[model samples]
Target chain A: MDTIDNLADNQPKLVGHDHVAQINPLLPLRKWLYSWLFDPGIPGNHQKAVDRWISILIVANLFALLFEHVDVIYEANKHWFHWFDIFSVAIFTVEYLVRLYLAPEDREFGGKKFPRLRYISSPFAVIDFLAVAPFFLQAVIAVDLRFLRSLRLLRILKLFRVLIPACRQFVKVNAGRTFRQKVHALVFAGEYGGTLHNIFDMFIALWVVVSVVAVVLESVQTVHYVLNLQFVILDAVAVAVFTVEYCMRIYSCVEEPGFQRAVLGRFKQARTPSVVIDFLAILPFFLEVFLHHLFDLRFLRVFRLARLLKLTRYTSATSTLTRVIVREWPVISAAAFVMLLLVVLTASLGYLFEHEAQPDKFENIPQSIYWAVVTLASVGYGDISPITPAGRAMTIILALLGIGIFAIPAALFSAAFSDELTKEREKLKRDLYEMLADGVISPDEAAIINREARRLHLRQNEVDHMIEKARNDRESVADLSGLPIHRIAAKPEHAIEHYKALLGQIRQLGILTDGLQFEQLARQADRLTSSELALWRQIHGNHQSQP
Target chain B: MTDTPEQSGVPLALAPALTLADMSFLVFLAAILMAVVWLGRIAYLEGVKTEVTKASGEAWVQWFTEASPKRFTPGFEPSSCAGGASPAGTNGKSAGSDAGASVNPVPERLWEGCLESLMKDVEPIAGLRNPFSGKPLMFAAKCDTDDRSLVGAMVLEKLTPTPPGSAVAYTTSSLVGADIIERKLQLRVTVCDKGAYPIRIAEVEF
Candidate 1:
């Protein structure tokens, strides 16, 4: 503790060495270092570049560590590995030392006698210490190889530190943005024009594709062995991005429509289908870390493929399919149950008929189910077949029934999908018409239409087309416009405009002198003197109603 | 490789027995790692160009462990196998006397200390032994118990510089009978090779 306090007291007093004050050279240097390392307000790109360099160095060190384990690679590049380790460790050491020196510069960390000590004891500070300690220890002390390896694995934990804040600023939108509101805007489709939110979502979709592809390609044994490090890097990057996304969604889920209350909103979102997919996507990564030894983690990694499920939120087609299935669940489920019944019935029948002929093949009911699945799914692996006449007849009957039985669900889904597509398009059209009610487009009005279109997973071009159609429809209606006196007095504000236009047209007919002439006679007709009645009679040659 | 029949399976890797000093050192290393990562995060969040570098260095470390040939398999769980392990002492008479000292129906906490990661029931190698046994000396004693699954002592770890020719056998289950009181059971020594890992190559079972 005393050593830590002394270390804390020794924060870099020297920041800007050249501009150092005569009384205290350390203060300027400390300020300079703090800005260079911690302050994002720096206009210069140099500090930012330095951060990139560190990240690159970290990745490079990871590659180095990964290959360092392979026997052939280790044997060939022992010296390079050794020197690289030194160089990496030296850089990390310098970084750790500098960070420790400037620890007191952090706001919460300052104002204490041992602010540096407090910083050292903080979570990140401890990581920084451990990051460099291994190298120093390796030189002086002998460590158990396994223990050393675990220490090496500790490098991966650096991810939590790097990514936690990259997405943190996104959460902090201006003054009024609640975490829940941001989540609603980001996770759900309807937005009042948030380009950044949409772009972030697109990037997430892209990553999902890339990660799923990476996971699939990793199945090739040659690829797995030769590019194992690359795969690892990919998985790690995916996990980090996904972890950030999952946390962001949870944090701001309260802004979701149904999830209005603070804690309950998040809980409700947690149980939701799309949100469940998001959770499953990252759960494997964490579970493997916590329970690696208890279960076969190698098999567990295949679960990462579930990241594909996340794309459902971004595409109307998939979400539509989901909705169609949900709407037609009763039919589909009954079809499924019938198919299951067929499988059992067929298996039992095969057992009875083929048992006498091929006892070895039809050994048990469970074994025969494989044949049933093969026949019913129409896969027909030909690995199993019926030898007896009765069995062959049963097979033909089951196969004929299988086609219709399976098609029930497929046909049901197809019909439902078609209906859903029509509904969604109609919904979009309705939203567009609502926005164009006044026959003029405002930016806010346009945004609402766009948000609605986005919620329906409509493309930008599609949205533009739909809005254009709405505008054309509005213009086609005589009620929407007034050519002379064509507009209907649909609204109070439009009513005045409509009357003025009608008077203008009447005056243009060369009958009345002006619009005021028309207005004046109409207002004074009840108590009109003899001259007013004479003017009104002169303008109305064809008028039938005297009043 | 010479003493035993050649095994077809992947060879077991060594997990070095961590002493108190080594554990302290690891804790220090963990601390530094956390601190640097925090500083890096603060730098990145504060608008450092760290975002440009997408990889968080996690994959490399994870792959390093996962892809390694010397991976840990299902070795042993002491809590599940043995109630507590101590070297078998003098005899069943002394063990009975110790049990008589305690008067209770429920089990008692005879002694409790953190068991080391990998230790054997007895040191199989000439110079080495279970570090808990104050190395260079080894013993076997009986325990007072009625629990059938209670193992008096077990070979929890492998010896360092494992004998290449011997097959490494880690403890699967080592238990002491619950009903066995003091004079009921005695130390049964089993000199083994290729069983326990990186600590001692052999075990002496009681």
Candidate 2:
């Protein structure tokens, strides 16, 4: 026992080093190779080189798969595709074997029961196997689209999930920020993609869809028979998650400036559409349990589908549609008003025309109202028909009018949706510039901008594009005072607001804009004439009077 | 003629009503619409900022200081935002053989000499990290200790002409770097490692 203790004490400590094959002379090489294979590094590092090659191979394999299907391309490059497939399969096989050999390094696959088998069964490992298995199968048997390179592409696509957790770690180290800031970073901020809050939102969104589909399918008796138990469990879990989320959101509402009040903030949040949708989603399950004795509860489950509306908060397209509706409300409302008038007038006219001829079918104007709406909306049910000559003529005119009248809303929506999209981009660009005021972005600043972008429902790619655009604007466009004048003049309608702030600041500081500042003014003024320039001059010229 | 005689075809024939096919059509439409929404969300999230940068590499910002309110942020100490690798002691630190080395901001801090600083002048765009490894990445931009805040109401436009994207109505807005971005010039930025090792940038245009 003393010898063992002494030996252990005398053993060299490898504090900085990781577990490796110490007995082997080539351990360093092996460890290096392992890192090269699995670790992420700079662009030219061996690991990045291998990663890039693997990514390129994925794309190349997809292309090869596509070309093999095209008769003309296959006829000419059949040999090339065949050679490429074999080469890829060999590399993949090597990768699989190597990974299996090093399975002990991977924590999840480090257990007994033949680590290689455990590694082989992992989702990524299975994907890697699927990628190469098809080629081997094709050599022995005929396997085609049923098993192809698409699986490999899916493996590559999942790389973001791997990268984000690693990035989120960086921010967590600086734990000095307030709980509100941290929560905001996670829940509300969008600048950074991979955060605890983002993952939570994504998960809830997925469940929302799953629950909604389950609810809808439950109505179908056949599906209900096989999936009833699963639906019940799903509902229970969804309700639990939604309830917790509802409480958490209300708890965190005070973090938002608008909802900084303790009780009032929760009230404000409850009144919001997103909050209302969330509440409605879980309300049905509660109603069914509490109100079972009051009324038949089977129909209460239909309201479970309200969960789908909650997904709109996560989805951009739905929000885009919402914005379009809001933008074109006037025109759309007018069109709807016209449609309502047509429904009423046509119903009354049809009642007069067909009352004597078909008393049973259209006994009164109230009975004809349903028929008029059906015909006018172009959703002709054909339940009731006009048998008289005058009633038939009136029906024909209303149906023709319905085609044009109903189209108005669709056209207006499309136009407004396009407008909304443009506005969103501009907003992103402006946010990018404002965030970039110092020409550098701190993590907090990045988080705030990201949150702002998320509020605007801007995606990461579009955010990057706007950032690029903003960066370029700052660099290439400088007025005499070396300020980014172009960004100020980017949108004319908002220029007055910008000018108001600028003039307000000047007045507070008691400074005048002439010479260099005047030159900056002229550059901006050249872009705007009419009322915009007048407002700019008014704000600038009256700065002394305001103080 | 008797009214009962006016009945033409079969006396007990059923009238036209909704079929399973119509219900299926409506379900299919709903399915397609949902798929479209899901796809749009996925595409939006998967957006990459490659077109503007010369390299096919990704850059992200990191914070070194505990986040402070904008109102309380003192003039950024020259080496304030860098964590682990202090910019002050970085003088003459050779960019050894390591491919991604510690950044050697000998005279000026990283992010003190670039377009990123000029745009958002308040917090110098300092913290950058690798998209893959999540290791801290660095870029040099001219950083000045200028404090800025939105003093007046910010003006927002109906649509910003610089790019195509979503719309915000009745909000304060600004046209960012319009002169530079409108010129349609590629904004080139370099990314380096903490060891001042310059990572090779592959300009792979896909």
Candidate 3:
């Protein structure tokens, strides 16, 4: 306790004399470290960044462990691996020690009499200890080298510090009666999944990267010779994991709102683009194993790289891109049609002009189309160029036209991506405003906001700013209630926006708007002018008329 | 690799047998065929590259393991490769006694003041690696109590290492049960090859 106080005293003193600070001199340092490691509720604490670094460190340790087993790699980077291990051990030891010391302040254990003891026995604490124990043990004890290596492998379990809590939260959130509902909660990334679904998403995404890398590495002759068995094993494991995930998705797909009919729902789910990608990811392996004798299906092995597309399921950017493409499909297709027409027209003209001078090169329109495409794409390969003056002039004109025409799609895609991102941000702001309407963010609402913020890649400070702006917007809308009739008449757009906000607020009232509340709202409504009253009734009637 | 329909045993339906009612079915079948063709085209474009060259008449297969001479069979011997030869003695193990006989006794309570990772169980602990240092750290004891039912004393000696040339070798040592007078005990013992890792006991209880 004195050591903790001394450590606290050495730091710049805070002015607060709160009950906690007064009772325990160690509270300041403990709370600061605790907030940094675990909680984000404390202002100025970068819990997210801390979590990210720790997660990165854990992944790095796993990579180091993997490299240690590869003889050439270990031999070459022996000093690096040794120092990296020491650095990792130091970080993990400090983390474990700090967490242990701050256990009394942790939310779950704070109320317990022996909080430190309870924390030590917790699964996360055990994992943390295991992560740091190996290095210290190796330093002090004469232990078998193989035994030490296996213990180092336990560092992988330290990831459970993040995963286990998410799993528990997911289970708690999806405490439904049916297994189908629970499975749905686990797999999908909407209301129920929160953190757990992201973890699962990340796991599948990591495998996708691994399998793609293996496929790429297999192309190298020396690497293939040395790691053929390992590559095969990794591929097999990837396929097995993807196959199980695909099966699970197909099974629980009926829990989705539209996919309620079992057979048709499963089929529909399979037909979806993401699910199709999932199927393709595992299909090549099965085809090679089962149908290779029928044909040279080893060619199908290349399709294993399609597993990379499975990552689109986890990234919001892909979804945004998909939305952009869908929204601008007509325009994009129009551009493509124009480009195709230009290619044909250019090919015909090139043949007409150059056919006489270079019969072999421009023998036919079909062959000339290749030159047309290449020329239009600005890739002027010297293998095919018109030598005749008329042909050269025509070629110059066609190339200029191609440049302009080809850029249409590129420009459109970039603009659409930007527009989509802005629209998503706007939608997030609107959601924040709606959530802030009731003046308090419920736990569920907070979770939704956090998930949306993450999906949009908005920082915590940015989200806080948005929340503040939303609160102001809500207040401004409410402020319209006390405005004079003349002022309301002067700003028609403001009145309409105010009306919509009021409707949203009233809708949120739902069955909670009892007689007293109704009377209060009625009294407030009584003060409105005839025009405002008529507009309100019209909007209200329209809303009521809708199913 | 292409085979004729007759050789492939692919039965063909007569084109003249189709009618207007079959048009929708024909379109669906064509769509399926188109999808398959598209997939095949993609696979062909991305197929694994294979290189081949004409060879002289003779061919053979050679197979061998570390202890066996290479044996050749017809039509499978690979092209000769050079520059991997090493003297036989270059890969031999160093001259040292087997690890089992290298265990040495050390002073009791050698690690008295240090932090340690520990586990206690009635059954023998298997694969008990230290959670802190991530090393195989375990000490097992079967205590003998006096008639008064008090644990008198305990001494945990490291078990003998696995015999050389055994089917499986385990590095973990077992504790032989014993009787002693003290309620608490501490000891350190060297237990690995060339005294590389020493097991130190900070404290132990029956």
Each candidate's DockQ: 0.02, 0.00, 0.01
Predicted model with the maximum DockQ: 1
User: Could you give candidate 3's per-residue lDDT for residues A312-378 as a string of tens digits?
Assistant: 7767888788889999999999999999999999899889999999999999999999999999999
Once fitted onto the true fold, the runs of candidate 1 whose alpha carbons sit more than 4 angstroms away are: A1-195, A452-547, B1-206
DockQ comparison, 1 vs 2, better candidate: 1
Name the better of 2 and 3 by TM-score: 3
Model 2: per-residue lDDT, tens digit, A1-547? 1111132233222211122223433556645556546644322235544544775576567656754665555777779987887887788788777877777655565556776788878777776776676666666876555455454455444344344554455254324444434444455533322445555676688678778888888777544433434556567767766766675576556777698887898799889988898899877766665563355455677888888888777667776787788878889999999988888899999999988988987899889899998998889888898888898999899999999998898888888877887887687677767755555554455555655666666665666567668866764453313334554565563466567667677555435444345535545667645475455556556542221
Distance from true location, Cα of A330 in model 3, Å: 3.7
Q: Tens digits of per-residue lDDT for model 1 on A1-547? A: 1111122243222111112222323558887677656655544424445655766676677767877776656887899988987897788778778878887777768788899889889887687678778777887999876577568665555544554554443333312443344445665554321444655676698789878988988787544434445565566667667766776676666665687776788788889888899988877766655553354355777989999989888666766777888888888889899999999999999999998899999998999999998998888999899999999999999998888887888888888987988897887687767656655554455445555665666665676577678755664554524332223433555567566665566445635355456546665775666676555555545341343
Global lDDT scores for all candidate models: 0.56, 0.55, 0.61
Off by over 4 Å in 2: A1-37, A40-194, A317-320, A429-547, B1-206
- The TM-score ranking, best first, is 3, 1, 2
> Pick by lDDT: which candidate is best?
3
Best by TM-score: 3
Ranking by DockQ: 1, 3, 2
